[model samples]
Target: MHRSVLPLVRQTLGKHPAMMGVASAATGFMRQMSIKPFTPANRRREFQLKDRVESLHACRTQIFKEKGVGELPTIVVGGFVPDATEQVEFQRPLFREYGSVYYLNYPRHGFSLEMFFAQLADLIEYLNARRQRPVLFGVSFGCGLIAQFLKESANDPNLKIRGVALASPVLCTADLIRPEGEKAGGVRMLESNLKRILKSAAEGSEGVERQIERARRCFQALFETGAANRALTGRHLSIRKKIMHVIETTPADGGYQRVLALQQLDGPRDGEAVFTGPTLALLAEAEDNLLVPTSPTLSLLRDPERRRHLFPRLSFWKVTSPEPDDAVAHASLIFHHHCYNPLIRSWYHKLQAPQLFAVI
Candidate 1:
């Protein structure tokens, strides 16, 4: 019976043109895989990029393998991105010591558990077949995937994972998803507007259609402004907001709420539950768009009891500077330009070195 749902789901997903774009915009969801044109300069650039990282297209996954020492500590880094494009060139040098660096891409315009788990299963199988144990490091939603892996492989002894690390983990409670009263910033305002729009669509839109369009336009403006200001990256945050608000407003009538259901699950609290191996977490300072201060998901990790109990081995480096005016610091919320600054890169390598990657 479950096998019968796949085709209908795909059909429904493809039915709406806007849904396709929404999906793509959500995950940098470009589906076409085009080879760059063969110009000498382009070839040279590709070669240079290839030298830094090897790209592999295999069975619903695009893996970017970085140059590693070949015989050092084995490790693999993966995430929810359709393509780990932004992280491709970042901190390449650090990966050199690892036996390999693999960034697994999500399925086109999607981050589905079945697809993600299958790909991960393949990776783990490939690694298990090898002579060494692989160190797995996941960031953000990647951390959630790691949790799944841990749950699935708890009894399997051959899969040697050195540790797990999550940067600004997503953990949340129920009530926070839908809050009453005034929204604080552009992000919340946009979310509020989008929620209203989706509700109008789900219910029969009579005169409500015009109001919905107006709200949609307002939300679009917020997205554009955020993107222009560099607060949001293209359309990622806006799509995220859309999805969050949709689920939040969805009727509690049981079937499977999926995303929101996951949001309600309990995760190992910060410093509360020590993982099987070494653990590291880069607690972002409030300003990082990757982890907003008000996110209910992050509150799970902030609890003192949870921190003390679960993350005893967890090493945390504030992803921000202690002072707001320190423009050079990585976590300065007001001035996020620091995220890409070279000094911040150094901080990442430094923190990553002592915690996740042992000196080889």
Candidate 2:
């Protein structure tokens, strides 16, 4: 139910900037109520960092070492999952081949974008203390987080980021929600479909639990309907179940607050100047199930003229498969280890080469 309201609010804001103050205040109150206060106990239990200022949870995957090497390079992953234990474990084989991997988890189900950025900074500092700069790998929302971090920490001497790899990066929220012309109609259609899911669940239960149930149903319908290519339905079904589990368990208010934060994000426009490092952006050829129309970020990256100006150092790849399922193509870009792992390896090697960074 609340999911429907969020987009309406964003659409309203686009038309009338006068409501910005009221909207911001409302958003602030929601964020304050939903996000849990950070504490030392949480730090000890979740992060296992003995000397801790705040709490941050992460799943660490160590690389296999030969006898004499000092230590393998580290890869810090930023993902959308609040509890990423299983997801991180699933990527163990792929990440282990490159270096050590750490999949970070948020302290609570709901947190503001600022809080997320700060937590990522803390993780980077912790890693930098033990090692030097670590490669950053971000998927979906994680990509936006990494880009913001790069912007904020641009001039910091101690925080050197080695490289970045983004999979299905969400560069512009507006591009996804408020597309122009016919695409805008498609978004409305998708929203209408989502509302139908909520309407069907209205009779089952009442209160917060019911709302969560409806939200879960709403997402399930979106995932199912957005899946154009039936070939990937089996894999999508499995992923969708996990996603639904997260949505079901998360507090309703927190989930809504997170959505509000995403709505407010301006994406790469503000952060482009600072992101001058080796970057690999993997984009799916088909429309994302989550974002029905292709995002402006993807369009910008695809255009040679815009790409040259915005992401000069970025290596872009438009990934596609012969399979009929567009959703499968999108999912495979991230989950299909055999296809993407080698690409990551090659990029990592190129980033490490002194000559690559020496001149032009």
Candidate 3:
């Protein structure tokens, strides 16, 4: 009973029956005001428009500055997945490689081709406020967008880029995914079942023991692009395994922008781009050719004899690990950063040399 009704209880004890009923009514009113209802409604739909907005707000450009750095900040555009929220082995090694690092973070749903270019351009302009020329590093699908951006801004005198590095280059999306027939996607190269296989291999289970065993076999074949005998191990091999799983398992809505980008062909235009300082292409040991195996654009870029016909100066390096045990897979930079960062560090330093040294 409410303390406020205690006096009423006393008063009603000696009162008439009619007065007692009135006191009972007062007590019920006080009780209603003091206590909560038995059942409450839950209105959250999780990823309702509001939740998407809130999650997106949590993502933004993350900056890591190497102390005492001033120019040519390296900006890395990640593909598909945003750098993991926590315990992500992918990002943060770039700043340690050279100067400041500008890593793009996509709001859960705000990532798109147009958004990438806009955000990248804005970041460059913002940092250029102090008159610095930034270098661009593109990873996976990000390579396609950067290539297109370079083509579009080829003639823009105001847009001055120092150099570019493409990791596991996806110069063309149609290369990764091809339209097979009308009824459903073939059966294209990157099959959906691959995700299940990777997941099976990464997180083993007795329920799917047979499938897990099968995937472990195919998983080794995944490294066939580099060396069939290479059994990967070390620091972030397991982390890379998780990243590979996310790439294939990401929900449709989560990877909508990238999936949409897969349809159009962003082929490199023969003699078009202007900012050709020091373009470096780093292909993962296991992804040297499997990705975009028949991509004419990538083939042209990788062909040393023909690439210079387009890019006046270029450097191509296949990322390899000195220690045989390091798992230098497609997302090799994050998983085995030690293998790639020093190369990037050296490349960043070379960008300061005179034009004569720009060519390999």
All candidates in order of TM-score, best leading: 2, 3, 1
Model 1, span 151-255: residue lDDT tens: 655776656665565554543322123454534443444344434544554565452454444544553453344345332332344344543343333232211
- The lDDT for every candidate, in the order shown, is 0.44, 0.52, 0.54
lDDT, residue 81, model 1: 24
Instruction: Show model 1 residue runs off by greater than 4 Å.
Output: 1-59, 70-82, 172-274, 287-297, 303-305, 321-360
Cα lDDT tens digits for candidate 3, 40-143: 02212222333334343432333333322445566667665534221223344444344555555444433444444555666666666666667787787667
Task: Give a tens-digit lDDT track for model 2, residues 1-360.
Answer: 497686665667646645654554564454334323322112222233423433222112111211112122444443444233323333445555545555555434455555555555555565567664566777766676677667767877766677777877775455445533456435544344333333444454344345555655665555455443333322233444455566567665454444455555667552355377777887766545455555667666667767656666888876665454432344343245545566666776776666345545
Model 2 alpha-carbon drift over 4 Å, by segment: 1-90, 179-185, 188-214, 221-244, 292-294, 322-328, 331-335, 355-360
Off by over 4 Å in 3: 1-68, 82-94, 178-251, 323-327, 353-360
Question: Which lDDT value does model 3 have at 186?
Answer: 34
Scored by lDDT, the top model is 3
Cα deviation of 112, candidate 3, in Å: 2.8
TM-score of each: 0.52, 0.64, 0.60
On TM-score, the leading prediction is 2
Model 1 TM-score, 2 decimals: 0.52
Candidate 1, position 179, lDDT: 53
Cα error of candidate 2 at position 149, Å: 2.0
